[model samples]
Target: MGRKKNQAMSVAETDREFVLGAAARLFRQKGFDKTTVKEIAEACGMLPGSLHYRYPSKESILVDLMRLALEQASGSLSEAIKGECDPLEQVRLGINAHLELLVGGSDKVYVLLFEWRSLHGASRQEMIDLRDRYELLWSAMLKSLSSQGLIRADVDRDLLRLIGLGALNWVATWFNEDGRYTVKDIGDFVWAVIKDGVIKR
Candidate 1:
């Protein structure tokens, strides 16, 4: 009726596995409209009652899944760029960190991206706010470049940020580890696109 007893996994580890593996997989496969809390609990090796004790609704699980994705990704990007003074390098590392998380195939993040629209009411608004907060990381990174005059004055920094992130996030849908381009390479290409317009050199 509860989480397994005396397990080697800590609460945080189990939660990560739940979001990254079992619950994420279930949500990704069946979708929020179709997935049940009972199924999620069973997948995580807990009883349905225990799952309810933790998350009253599937939307709550979705909310936490998204919250964790943003938190972890934001933390990683921030740490990756820490103490690096070059705005260009920060942009490179930040974009690379974002792609690495995406292409690493974290099902938790996948559900966050694909199933965010499934959230509703307070849950939806909560996620939107959290997502925007997370986005400020990227916004600030782009703005840093603009302040240094690395980007053109005529370029709409907000538009570039939105389009650049959209393009990078979509990489998860088609990226392959077995492919020629590593995640870093993809980041490089994307940054190059932003830095240099797609004109023939």
Candidate 2:
């Protein structure tokens, strides 16, 4: 009985993953407004009724996808910060983890960034809260580094946050595996700009 129950649980987990993965692809291709429950269900090779058994609506699927992405990103960031002594190393790890999301989970990341606003009421607010909390995590690290006199005093906290997020968020749009600059190269270049200014010394 225990083995049977475990098999059932595994199947349920696999189905949930399937639904989210299909939803992410559809959302990225069509955007939130254009995608429908029927479309997503078809994309997953399931009927609408079957899809409804897993998710109540298209919006719920998108919300679940967003939740999965955020959870993964939070986990990565947490792991990157563990037992790290240097503030700059923390910053580098955090940025690298974030950029890796763009590189590895581009479809989900793109949908999360562009289609998130389509989520309504409680769902929208929940994602917003999670995103804001994530931002605070990065900002806290930056502030700590500045407090230690590691980063320059002239760095504006809000401006730094904006620049960092803006730079990383759009990475999925233009990033190519065959491109001259790899993700690591891009991350390092961005970090150098953040640490040092554009001016020649």
Candidate 3:
């Protein structure tokens, strides 16, 4: 037989991708606190020792998953708003980008939303700092909109940032592929609500 392709995959891109994906699924299905490194190894079709060599601990896998999630969400939002100068349209596209993550984004992204409390100590703070950094992307954009008078002068951009994200994140709890609302429908309704209530008339 030719040299086995799978033999070389143990330390390559395939291993990392497969391990992270399997770990993400297990995290979502079993909850991060309950899932074990051995289980993640089994899910990856690799030995626990091999996984331990890469991750060392279960928390290490979680931190990586959350980091991956933040990158995906932030990147999606940034790409959606790129080339758009209209503050109103920028906000609309941004809202759609966020909502899209609930449906189209990876299991790691979902894990980030629901499993973040699993981390403790330095890991928890690291995730928090990264999350805050992601939120600042929106904070800056919102401030720009407010300064341009596109947002209501009385509206608190800080509150809007917090409350807006809360509302968007909440969609993941009830959103379903078979539900009455499509992602676009949810996006449109959310944008409408923001436009009517928050944007300057």
The global C-alpha lDDT for each of the candidates, from Candidate 1 onward, is 0.81, 0.83, 0.87
| lDDT minimum window of 10 residues, candidate 1 | 1-10
Model 2, clash count?
0
In terms of lDDT, model 1 sits at: 0.81
Q: Which pairs of residues clash in candidate 2, taking residues 3 or more apart in a chain or in different chains?
A: none
- lDDT tens digits, residue span 25-131, model 2: 88888888898999998888999999998788778888888887787778888898889978788988888988888788557777888886788999999999888
Cα lDDT of candidate 3 equals 0.87
Instruction: Flag clash pairs in model 1.
Output: none
Weakest lDDT window of 10 consecutive positions for candidate 2: 192-201
- Residue 122, model 1: Cα distance from true site in angstroms: 1.6
**Model 1 regions more than 4 Å off:** 1-20, 198-201
TM-score of candidate 3 versus the correct structure, residues matched by position: 0.90
TM-score of 2: 0.84
As for candidate 3, its clashing pairs are none
Question: Lowest lDDT 10-mer window, candidate 3?
Answer: 1-10
